[model samples]
Target: MRSIQALPEFHVFFNDHVVNNFNTLFISMPSSKEYYATGVSGSVHNRLFPKASFDFIHTSYSLQWLSKLLKELVDKQSLAWNKGKVSYPNSAKEVVEAYKMHFGKDIEWFFNARALEIVSLEILWFFLIPSVADSHCKCVIIAVFDLLGSALMELAVQGLVDEDKVDNCNLSIPDEIASLIESNNGDFI
Candidate 1:
């Protein structure tokens, strides 16, 4: 069994808390193996693991980064800062739709891969960015904003600021991704 979830501030904080409480075996190590990185909906299933090899899986705050919806819309402004124009958010509906499609598919693959795992109890949790709730504790919100702003500035320099686009789609919740996971698993807690 495997668990797939978003990577949110709360999730990170909670993970650390649980680790501290349980004194469990947790390794804060970077990947030593060469791993493939792609968009959320791209092909994590294949890159992260072979077919049905994992016993458990976990993803947090990572999937939201794949939301090309807002990224596509902000892409126009991204280009204004630069000169390259591969695809603008305002270019066509397909771009936005493509973003959504990729995001949805990413969610699907995450769950499907987890279902193929052999664990008996898979626990999945997630965290989302730019959360709508006011309970985020000001520190987390400010930190996330600072990080996002800095990354956007870098993207602006590289002519890739589609990340700053208008957020018309309210798809910033882990629940949406969690739903996909539950659809494939037994229960969601």
Candidate 2:
């Protein structure tokens, strides 16, 4: 960052999906003499910049979001119909497969786009030195989400939220994401 005198000045792009509040970001962003900030709004699955536009790119707590909800989960006739559950935990095999396949496609698109946008020999730092949480901690988080789903189910039972609404909803966590990043072997980073 600005503290590093050895590195050249770099442009900072604050990005999010198109609906992000850019005004708040601009107002809240730290003013720096060493770098200028630009706001870029778009999905990483699609190119948000010209080829070789950046020498560095970073993402954090982002890949957990899916590109979009999988249609198969809402389609009652589909094998992947995910009724009565919001998260994939304890879901049917078909549901897990659907989420896995969707994650694969999403991350592929992500890599493809980043591959085009970055300069050769530049750093993507996509993982950004992720700190692994222990399994028990991960389970606690998943358990929290499960409790939320259970509450929604209770509401559906009381005719508060329609049952179909619960069926169509899902939380994205992409369990296969770590493997996907490793499989790329630095080619797309």
Candidate 3:
């Protein structure tokens, strides 16, 4: 639980889409901020830094975004075509499995890039809300996503948005990331 305060000197980097205002982020800095701040632009799935550039890396409420939408989900001919759904709560087995498979790759991209970027034997801390296998929580979450789908359907009915577009969209429900880590044959673990 030791913080950067323990270090006499440390650097902090902020990363997000290229469209984010880096000036605003730097301007809203803490009064006691002692570390250097650098803003990195682009997807985390790609390499953003040189090897051994950092000793510690951390991810917060990000990482939910897949590197890209699964081609199968977007293709009409694919069995994984998630039709008319914003979330996978009520999706078919094929659709759900497709999402899980895609997430595995997306997460691997994130980890693989970090593995190359971070210093050897250092910590790579990340945070993500994975879909729990619990029953009550599952039911509640299913209801919520179903409601969201219904809302999008209403928008489509009103002609505010294209129905086909809504059908093409799919919200992420990441499977157990711990399992992904366990299955890794890499040296990071």
Candidate 4:
């Protein structure tokens, strides 16, 4: 927080796909702050800034939502199609692989896009609820999603929820930080 206050001048850009809520965001910005705030409404899968324009970038709990679900999961003819579950569990190997593949592509796209926008050695802080198993693990987010999927499955069994709708939904958890490092050639830390 001190580093933020110490900066000479800075501009904070809030980017999202939704434009209607931006007016509320702009109004909430402090008028007395030393920095400026701007909103850019778009998908992060594409470039959002000019080359070497940002010194720092931060993303929190957003990258898990892929731009689209995995192709095989949506294709009716594919054997790897996710027919019943809204999200992947360890039990479903093919579904898990599909989610992982999609996540890898999404993360690669994110890093490549940011690499163009961020200056050399600049910082990129990604805050996510890691899907790691530990003694002290409290993965509430994952648990909530799992519960939701379970609920949807139950509703589908009761003929209340559409099976296709549940089958098409997925939330990816990119837990392989080392893989991301390796894929990006160690350019980002």
Best by lDDT: 3
Where in model 2 is the C-alpha error above 4 Å? 1-8, 30-35, 127-138, 157-163, 182-184
Candidate 4, residue 103: the lDDT equals 74
Residue-wise lDDT of candidate 4 within 1-189, one digit each (tens)?
355555477778888886559988878878886777888987786689999998888888778778776788888788668666555553256766776777777777788888898887558887765764332344776667778888998998999988888888776766665677786787642
Worst 10 residues of 3 by lDDT: 132-141
Better candidate by TM-score, 1 or 2: 2
Query: Using Cα atoms with residue i matched to residue i, what is each candidate's TM-score against the true structure?
Result: 0.37, 0.76, 0.79, 0.78
**TM-score of candidate 3 to 2 decimals:** 0.79
lDDT of 3 at 59: 89
Estimate the Cα RMSD of every predicted model relative to the unseen true structure: 13.0, 4.6, 4.2, 4.6
lDDT digits (tens) for residues 70-173 of candidate 2: 88889999888878888775677788788778878888888888888878646767552122233234565577778888999999999999988888778865
Error of 3 at 125 (Å): 1.1
lDDT of 3 by residue, 1-189 (tens): 866565567688899989999999888999685678899998887889998888889988577777777888888898888887887746677887887888788888888889888887468887866564432456655677778888999999999989998987787767568788788855432
The per-residue C-alpha lDDT of model 1 at residue 127 equals 51
Provide the global lDDT of candidate 3 against the true structure: 0.78
Clash count of each predicted structure: 12, 0, 0, 0
